[model samples]
Target: MDRLTAETKIAELTKRIERHNRLYYEEDRPEISDQEYDQLVRDLQELEAKFPDLAKEDSPTRRVGGQPLPFFEKVVHKTPMLSLGNAFSEEDLRDFDRRVRQAVGNQTVRYVGELKIDGLAVSLRYDNGVFVQGATRGDGTTGEDITQNLRTIRSIPLRLTRPVSLEVRGEAYMSKGAFERLNKEREEKGEALFANPRNSAAGSLRQLDPKIAASRQLDTFIYGIGELQGETVESHSEGLALLEELGFAVNPERRVFDNIDDVIAFIASWTEKRPSLPYEIDGMVIKVDSYAQQEELGFTAKSPRWAIAYKFPAEEAVTVLEGIEVSVGRTGAVTPTALLKPVSLAGTTVKRASLHNEDIIREKGLLIGDHVVVKKAGDIIPEIIAVLPERRTGDETPFSMPTHCPECGSELVRLEDEVALRCINPMCPALIREGMIHFVSRTAMNIDGLGEKVVAQLFNDGIIHSVADLYYLHQQRDVLLGMERMGEKSVDNLLAAIEASKQNSLERVLFGLGIRLVGAKAARVIAEHFGTMDAIMQASEEEFTQIDEIGPKMAASLVNYFAQPQAKAVIERLKAAGVNMEYKGLRVEAGEDLPFAGKTIVLTGTLSQMSRQEAEEAIARLGGKVTGSVSKKTDLVIAGEKAGSKLEKAEKLGVAVMDEAGFLQVLEGNG
Candidate 1:
């Protein structure tokens, strides 16, 4: 095609792609599949590559994010981001309404009640329809510029529908489903899990690498406007409407109430229905709808007098600890659960709560038959927070850690570094069963139709002894079909899923192995370094330690794990079954003219351009070695936001200290 034709085609593709982005992100209604959208993007990219000079800076491709800033620049809000005073009860809400009415001289009024999403508050700025900046609500005065990271949130429009300048306030939040998925993935990787959706959303947005933020699938609700040009709204509700029209996501659950009684009713309704929502809501934000009335009410030194947050009461219940149940995980760690007298807590009936470990049980002085305060941790998982010593009867039994595995009768031992008592027997039936379950989990091999029930049935019936046995199940199709609840079609689907898992990356296989201390992140690191299961199996402790994130303990664990005859046999069987054992990700061989190639690079402090994980992965892809510490042997130290002792140490050691800008330059092969 000619350059003119290509240019016209690119424009058409950009328009269509932007519209689709709006439909999918802003409206939450996608007409086209992901594959179709990707094809359009690819077409535009191809055209842009062909007609390079015709490309525009504000092109849709910019949303993909190639510009990486080293650190976030500070942004001073044009208007101070004020906090809202909180009301804990209906009386408090009434008092707030009374004060507002008094200030407005008992004029006719309306209040907008919105669900207070538990998330990070951020400000977005636009210049002539183009999104220019985004920042956190730091101290309500200044915040770190997170423009690039914000752009990755598809819900946040890159350009306004109208060519008008505006500044809006929003809450960037991760949905409950996304949060659960993220935490599950993190748990599988053996990384520290985020406590709640709020923290996860905050962390995801703060990631310097836009790609990291993009992968998190974050959404936002523009609640209020900081400033707007060429427009005027009489009330907060009208401003929200204008924001929605300008391609910003506004929470649809907000209600405008004519009376405080109605507003209180709205708050009460949400307190009960909050859990039903896809995201978490901590409270209801009640604001005077009239912009004139808000100005009249004015602001205090810290918060707005016009708005108040009615926080929901904590959901807690007193329940009797009937008994302690010990369960073994795939890692052989024995967890103690509190079997509680069924009590209604939060949105569900709680019959059990996680005691976590012996430390927790001892710390809370929890005893069987003792009354305990049970509450949902982060309003999700039921947990025993405290024991009421006064309610303990003489018949209460002191709970003790199990001396042996309940399932396999093997001796349980507590490792020096660990708090939980673990069953060390590799061949223990409980460990084997749990290992099989973990291997087929969503974050592991991801084999479908192999849930807890199916896995238990397979194990109890002696149909499968190890993870490798799953691959060979196709040969036993008739036998599987003959089992209760297992039809021909069900067996076929199960076999198909198992077969499909063979093509998974070596990282998944490594994680599925249930190696001690090997999480999803560690698995990926080890797999990428070794490039194959055979290479990992042959690697020595010293070789394993050479990889970033792998330490002496982890190295020894991997070495000891691979040395096991049973483990090696399982891997061999899997290999024989045509299961892939090689890493399927990008590999950087020894001889590349990359700037980071063959260098021991240590990242210190917070990187503003990308997450530490993203940076490490990128460095590895460029054949660089990433380590946690700085030493004389360190070739380069990339110090980011708040460069601490590591930076000083790097300087003292005469190691090269590169700033974020320098790191970006090096990444571009300009170093």
Candidate 2:
């Protein structure tokens, strides 16, 4: 009726929404259905739209997600996100305990042993209990600003239970269910699938758009604190407890171990039971119990020597090699996959492990009917770690590389410099599937809800025959709904995602197409130079090479890819589907808007603007390049405070140097 009435309405609605948010997110108990919650949010939106003056900055609706960030500005962490030392096996855990004991002398150190989440490390900042910022562990000093994206994670509390200004650290991970669903959706969209959960998590967090990140169904577990303004922590373990008490989602599996022996036993137990977990765990961290003891051990230039991350035996399990399936890649590389007996390993059921190459398979003497030992190298992929030759039956069939393309029966050939056997057939279904999967990968198209199962089902069902098939999926919602797990909501979400994917700018689509040899960085270069997907597809090999980062091999891949009738058809379908085939997004640069264009850069010290990864991404966007160390080849060194050996080396070599301020100027046009 009036402004006062609207204000009252908004206040009550905010309270109601907050309560429901707490129930669904914090307590995992929902009083309102998702649809009901959606309606409430819509009503709130409508109210806000009608009475703009009633809108509050602290509104729950403001926290859903926001616009795409051009780049992450660096924030100097008050306390460093130091990496923990690692331990492998029981003995390694014991050694860590012994080291802690010897360092602390006798003060009964009780450790906070936590599962080393095989996911991306992120930092969350809360100002007076209000979630304000979230960042990636770029270089442990500075990270990209991903606050909007981080808010999408339901597990990460938007507002602390109490008034506290604190920085919490944790693993941002994709659960088994989410990962599987993601892979399935990708399959349907002919998008490339994530190799493992860790990559998926990392990619999801790095998304420029928070909405994209939120759609991925990501979860997080706070494990440590960077800084707490109004709190005192007695022990590292106590700090974790404090985080939990304050309403931050901390990993519940953490335990306090008195002795290395007990820690070792704990490690052993997890090593055996890791498969039962929902997410990946690369290792276990053994930290000194007391905060004082941890401070005593101190830093060692880079990593803290006090805490060790004892990795579980890389999570290995045995499975029977049922069949050898070969898939042709976009690069024309033929990869053999070991179809295995469904065995649980590394938080996922292992049914297939990549053979990588014929050489690898031959090296392992992999044969059908042989028992195989599989492990996630970093607790990610189900790699055929080894073949159990002793378990091979007398009648086991020796596996051989396909002499021809399995999809089109074209003779398989290996590139001179490559170890892979490749099928050159353009019309190969497997290649298209693999290419599509790669296209939707986090590093590529980044379509949410698209995962392996959905892709395979779509392909098998003929709903998606090629990458172009994805663009048509929006037109086949009912057909997809008929498939298992493809509920109406899921189908609608998938269609909406597909529709959203079209507007993802040129570089993303370029990468999503799974162009052989054209990596992420290269895709950006192509997008910038060509400016349109049609132009990029029409570009010659010479044109590709003229774009920096596009080497001859990459050029050939681009040319060959565009040359394909099938690929061209897909592109046509994608274009016709209203995919934004151009780049109109922000290009952060100063002189020419190429922030890093033509600059040979070396990043040193702790950046306060963005994580090293975010910085790297920014550098690429600006057309600048970064080298690992200072050399004659270097252009400028962006030095933060305490920029160690690299600074010294830069000074010694007469390299042009810019302070963090100058770098920020170039990065943000601050000057």
Q: Which is the leading candidate under lDDT?
A: 1
Query: What tens digits encode model 1's per-residue C-alpha lDDT throughout 537-655?
Result: 99999999888689999999999998999999999999999999999876776466777777898877667777666687778777787775667899999888766656777889999
The digit string of per-residue lDDT tens for model 2 on 124-226 reads: 8889998888788864654567878887776777677788987788889888889999999999999987767878888888776788887898888877777
State the lDDT at 663 in candidate 2: 69
| lDDT scores of the candidates, listed in order | 0.84, 0.75
Spell out the clash pairs found in candidate 1.
Answer: 189-519, 189-520, 208-609, 208-610, 209-609, 209-610
Error of model 2, residue 73, in angstroms: 21
lDDT comparing candidate 2 with the true structure: 0.75
lDDT of 1 at 81: 93
After superposition, the stretches of candidate 1 with alpha carbons farther than 4 Å from their true spots are 1-249, 252-314, 593-671
Per-residue error (Å), model 2, residue 185: 26
RMSD (Cα, Å) of candidate 2? 10.0
